[model samples]
Target chain A: MDNLSMQKLLWGVFWITSLAIGMVVAGRLWHMRLLADVSVRSRVQQSLQLVAKREGWLISDMSIRSVTPDAVIIEHRQHMRGRDPRVCVRIPLGTLEILPCTS
Target chain B: MLLRVLVFGLLQGFAVLLAELHRYLGVHTDEAKYLLNIPYPHPPLMRWILETTDGWQHQEIFWRIVFASLLTQGTWFVWDMGRKLHKDQRVTLCGLWLFSGALLLQAGTLFMPTITAIETLFLCWILQRIEFLKRWSALIPLLWLEMLFVAYQGILFAPLIFVALRQSGIAPWQRWSAFLIPIGLLALYTPTNPLTIVATGSVSGMSMGMPLEESVARVLKLWVIGGSMALSVLGLYGMVKSKQYPLVLTLMLVTAYIFVGFRSFYAILFTPLLIAGLLSAPKLLKSSAFLLALQIAAGTAIFLYVPFPEYSSARSVGDALRVAGVHGDILIAGSFGHEWQYLMPGPVKRYRPDFTNDAAAIVCLDRCVAIDRQAWQRFPQTTEEVWVKIRD
Candidate 1:
């Protein structure tokens, strides 16, 4: 590869990486409202809806077994929040309560 | 488009899964690079998941990669978009996407679950950039658009976008006019410990080898991409003169060819061109197949012949992982670390990603003497039954 091609390739890598990353950030910035509008309410309501779906037990087959200031244990399902660096909270199986499928 | 993704995505996932060789990955290749006391975590994550979850053995390591491999397909989408705009339709872009660059080296084959997913996510965003900027043109959407413009981090294909745009008569900076995106993305990224990013080429603090090797490898990688691009242009010229645009996307094949030929992480951004080539142009298929054959054969020979000192599969390290599984976790007493994780089932990774707390770490140790006491100490919970298995 000649110097120009090398330069182009390097520049190609640098700018492309930069642009894609920049756009991802831009998307987040632009979509922040949409995401928040979607994420927070949906998170809580989805959990509640999940609870409501259970048969007899208020605890569905999967429910949070323990809640602490630092962590919340939603049994059986591991909820991973955050990308790039993922922050994960593992929910043990025992904590989950499966609600019978309502026929 | 959705079916296109599914058809190609499943093929990619299967290819990567089949290409994966457990012995090479988990036992001794990667850790050998860093020449570190620490191990990589791909296999240990799988082992840990297996141990922690109990008998879910039927669930193969392939599934873990599959979950995240969608992002791999997403990348294929972006490469396609760029190739389309270039009006080149003379090559097999998709096959090249899977076979070239670092992909040819069998990357996703040996690592953790999210490894492929992260690559995929970055690519999908690149694909969306065209539509968002072209149609929406809304300032509010620009914020979302802004997230994508990292200078050199992800979506390593942005330069291609600019290149294609400039070629197509779009003014420079016009595509990115809505928002100054890099600023917003800064929020999402935890600042790289500049030293680590430079020295390690990653944020994780994994200990590695002589700086010289890493630098040489990186330099060679850049060279390969440059060379491939020239070959692609040569290939493009060969086809462009022939007047075959409708059934084959030349630029898509070009981008795909370069990525597959170079075999680097950067290939992730270019895979989408393959998808695009497949969707729009089918003429590049013959060329793509030939290039892929050449790349795979050469890549296999390169890896097989390259000799870095610490990478020894000769030792009975393979037996240890199996024993460790029986023993709950092996605690190598005197032995230093090897690529235990990559050699093992992937998708099972450490939070730190440096691999200290990984299962492979527990299996292989700086001190090989620790192996004798492993039963009593490491898996204190399973001593009774586990020890008998070890003895027998």
Candidate 2:
């Protein structure tokens, strides 16, 4: 191969290598970050279960009222069938201590 | 000589000021994502740069300094670009000053895709103007790959490739191949660098067919934040008057951005052409110094007053964390948890119930996951509920 072709080959190789290395490094970093913790969804589910068990509500019947970064608010219907029968409980994150949520 | 010195001095001064203030700013959530190598949907090249350069650590202030340095050096490229395009020192000096005074001096220091895009645009311009691509036809593939990696948006400016190769005397087949090779290579890199993401984004961008009023508001913001309303208007006028490739390039960029999705930072790319137009009107040359002063004052005011909410919140949280001496399995929950992860002293993880431990401090940002308001030491900093576990 001529010098120009050789040069071209080297340039292509260098860039491809750089790109590959960069991508690999980025991927590895992402993988490490991913592995660092449990999935947020699973965590939220655990919180829900804890809240349900403590409140004497069936885990299946307890529906997620809202999900926030700090806590998941779970909604439960009281045994009393009346207007506005649904009651909401606050499961503050970290402690999972259920509290009465107003409004 | 005087104008050159003045422009350089102004650029350096603003660059230093930005670097100084950037130190106090909290690690923005976007910056955190990039630093931590979080798998964002956009192109990974910018993240790669951020992660590699910061040694795979959260060194936001250091990166800001580096960005500021690059912006200062970019002023030189802008000067040289003006000189090459206009072939007049006065035009070059005037354009340089105008560029130095623009809001870009502040925005360029940010750890965003804006700087990468601006740098890519500058390199593309330099390559074309120097006819470097024409001479080295083989380098086209490498350039394209680099452009794609650094700023996939660079693909939008592909007209420069044709302009570069237009009179290279290379056979039409070779010229066409030079331009076409990158598009083919893009497919090969698809597994790693997904062009589909760009396509998807573009399609979604189309779906977001903005109302005319909103579109006008955005354009107005682009002009004002880009540099100045007058400069953007003159830049448009100048491009039209020159009837050059720059005009076509400007139109392509503006149309793509406005119709596809508009961002004020994209103005960094347009400012150069605007400066070029400002220079074209020699009648405005006498008042150039006054314009520069006005722009400097304007940019400075924006820099000082513009309340970047993320940065402020980050700073406040970071300070509180530092004071609390937070460490060892820090659990960050809520929006911008990645940001807290970057600020934390030890292994910072997103809050998970299964992952909970007594030793771990749960930081609930924004609205704390319904934190027991009575028990946890609530650091009511910056209107966000910053909860740290005080007990087992």
Candidate 3:
């Protein structure tokens, strides 16, 4: 094939390959976001419950304020010493396994 | 037409301002270095400009304004270049939109030499295209000024300028003089040590001599994350189809820089050309607006959801040390220790293993914090710890 034709063929291949890769990446990111949306709140709640139980407090309410890959900030109302107050705690996901109840 | 361009510039400037605000609220190691005027590799022209303009005051508002202005100029130049190449206003507008939609704006927001270099490059390209230099002798001084201010990547474009001069029907001796004079003057009088500047080139966190697969994976990850996967793919396809050899060459050189451990910010330099190429692609022209919208949406989603590095922790730690009456000589020990060095209140000294004995405080992360628990007090709010020497 002539140089122009060869160049066109290579570009065609590149276009197809890039499109396929882009689709896969987009799909994976969307899937991850979906999973995070579904599971992150529940996970945060579980962690807060565990913390409350270990501290001998009643878990009145729990909510995840923010979710990051490495850390989650959870706001939970706990009844401690005859007082109920909302407390926000940042939990490092990496150290979750070493939490008092889990350990 | 002039009013429309002005509006576009205003929008681009506003976007840059937003990105700058985001940087201030989040982790920004390199930006801090530039603001603080910490010495590093590359020319000090960018830092000098920031300092002279009082960019360090008011939470770096002045710096942000300057950066936004330069970025607007860059966007305008890119649009003009696109118009020259494609001769279609719609296509040029799409190219500009693609660029304004991407994380390239985030790179432009930083107080870094890369953005300045990019703006200078565009100016050079524009000047060449316009035949602004009637005499070859005139380019020598211009070349010298560019070399002094533009980053190392700017050197790569020297040959292009040379080619332009040759094509302009300049006499052979005059062309050679234009090239040789800058080199001769730079070699004789440039204040910066060439060796030190070259050594500072490896700005990426990646270690040297990494495997080929790892390097390729790093580039791919950077493209996916930094450009938005859809836009990155489209941009690359566009470049290939457009057959813009200079754009391709620029992309390849940038990829090589990344492989050799330059930071991912370098990837953003390709955005203007990539956008131009994308707009030039025949298959993409029909759906250009739809694709541009998708890219903007994806870029926005990633920008909002992603957890960027928080340099605020380091600054807080630095504040804590200052409050505790610790001053002078801080030894930073960790993977990211160097990044936090600019947060030190005073002139930062190079980290030496022996300085651990005499330093006022030590800031360390991860394993360093774990190993030196007895000597270091763990800062409550951050992963890093401050080790204040107990002088009896």
Best by lDDT: 2
Chain B TM-scores, listed for every candidate in order, come to 0.44, 0.76, 0.71
List the DockQ of the predictions in order. Answer: 0.05, 0.03, 0.01
The sequence of per-residue lDDT tens digits that candidate 3 reaches over residues B32-114 is: 54554434444555755654543233545556655655655555555555554444545434444444333443543564544
Best-fitting candidate, measured by DockQ?
1
lDDT of 2 by residue, A1-103 (tens): 8756865685577456556755764554342232224575568667766665554343423545555667766665421101213568777779988777773
- Candidate 3 displacement at residue B75 in angstroms: 2.5
Candidate order by DockQ, decreasing, is 1, 2, 3
**Which pairs clash in the backbone of model 2?**
A69-B334, A70-B368, A70-B369, A71-B369, A92-B370, A93-B369
Local accuracy of candidate 3 as per-residue lDDT tens digits, A17-69: 43553464445344334224546646655665675444423232333444566
Ranking by lDDT: 2, 3, 1
Give candidates' CA RMSD values in order.
Answer: 15.9, 12.0, 20.7
Question: For residues B1-392, what per-residue lDDT tens digits would candidate 2 score against the true structure?
Answer: 99878867877776666777656655555566566544443455676676665443335666776677666656665565555343444443444434432344354245454564454546444553556544555555456556665554556657655655555456787567656655544443443322234444865485286687777676666555555555666656665676656545745665566545664445566555565555455454445556556656665565455455446365565566668776455555554445654565544544555444442456556344545545557665534555665654
A80 Cα displacement, candidate 2 (Å): 48
TM-scores for the candidates: 0.40, 0.67, 0.59
- How large is the interface RMSD of each prediction? 15.8, 17.6, 24.2
